[model samples]
Target: MKNILYTVLLVIGFSAAGTAQEINWVSLEEAVKLQKKNPKKIMMDVYTNWCGPCKMLDRNTFQNKDVAEYVNKHYYAVKFNAEGNEKINFNGREFANKGYNPANANRRNSVHDLAHYFSVRSYPTIVFLGDDSSLLAPVVGYQTPQQLELYLKLFKNNGHTVFKTQQDFQVYAEAFKPEFTN
Candidate 1:
């Protein structure tokens, strides 16, 4: 009976692991270099350490199996700390967290230049860039796996280009049948 119980536990563990999505997160510079080698859209998760919704996004939406797999396969995922002290260079310009205070690393610090450039006003903004490093969109706030799936599919499949108006997107969203299980 003990052996059977152990086998069942092992099976359940493996099954859970299989369903969990493992994301390969990279830095902005690394993602950009990789994009030059092989062109693909970039998905940047701009977040702050003190933001509760940002943490929830990391815990829920980013951990979703289908969302993770799709993002991993199609987009170069980057996790950018909005208040971090990291310097980033792109397109002959340098972006840095100039106002970052070491004393208050956990609390709200200075915003990164990149975040300012993108005009990110929210806690957790999912910024998508085109293959050529063009700004596609900046989606703000905490989005569920099912909610984010629509954007993922829209950008990955060039649905955004096709969606010229608000009505077009509304139609698409209304008709989209999400495959992600929560």
Candidate 2:
């Protein structure tokens, strides 16, 4: 009886894990292209390889099934390495990495100009932008899967323009009830 119970639990766990959706990460250039076509908002995960919390965010928060589904549905998600050499053009300006330290022991890459443009002071900062590439607001520090979901829905549903304060958003969020079938 105990063996059977263990087997059932294992199967259930694996099944839940299998149902978790993968994040469709698009390139900065490709994201821009898609934006022109779809005109959806942008969610950029600004990260660095050497950052521990960034890895945790990718594995824990981003891997959540709801986070993946909601982001894929509502925003063009982009994973950007702050120290990468890739060139990006935004708002008639070209941005590139100017802070790379090739000789550093940890191989820390230099921060890109765009990171500075966004005023990113830490790793794993999630920046949400409007359809026209304007800053909507950035959620700094680490967030759990559930915490991240609230912000994802808030931006996706155009809640920022309506609610002005934390209390207002909390009231609005509490009122929201989504029904998902199948």
Give every collision pair in model 2. 99-110, 100-110
Off by over 4 Å in 1: 1-19
Writing each residue's lDDT as its tens digit, candidate 2 over 9-99 gives 9999999888879889997678778889889889999988788999999988788777788789889999988877778987788998766
- Model 1 lDDT-worst window of ten: 16-25
What does candidate 1's lDDT look like per residue over 1-182, in tens digits?
99999999999999987878777899988988999999989999999989999999999999988888999999999999999999999778999987789987999998989999999988899999999888999999999999999899889888899877999989999999988877
Q: Indicate the worst ten consecutive residues by lDDT in candidate 2.
A: 173-182
Candidate 1 has what TM-score?
Answer: 0.90
Where model 2 places Cα greater than 4 Å from the true spot, the runs are 1-19, 165-182
Pairs with backbone N, CA or C atoms under 3 Å apart (clashes), candidate 1: none
User: Local distance difference test, per candidate?
Assistant: 0.92, 0.83
What value of lDDT does candidate 1 attain over all alpha carbons?
A: 0.92
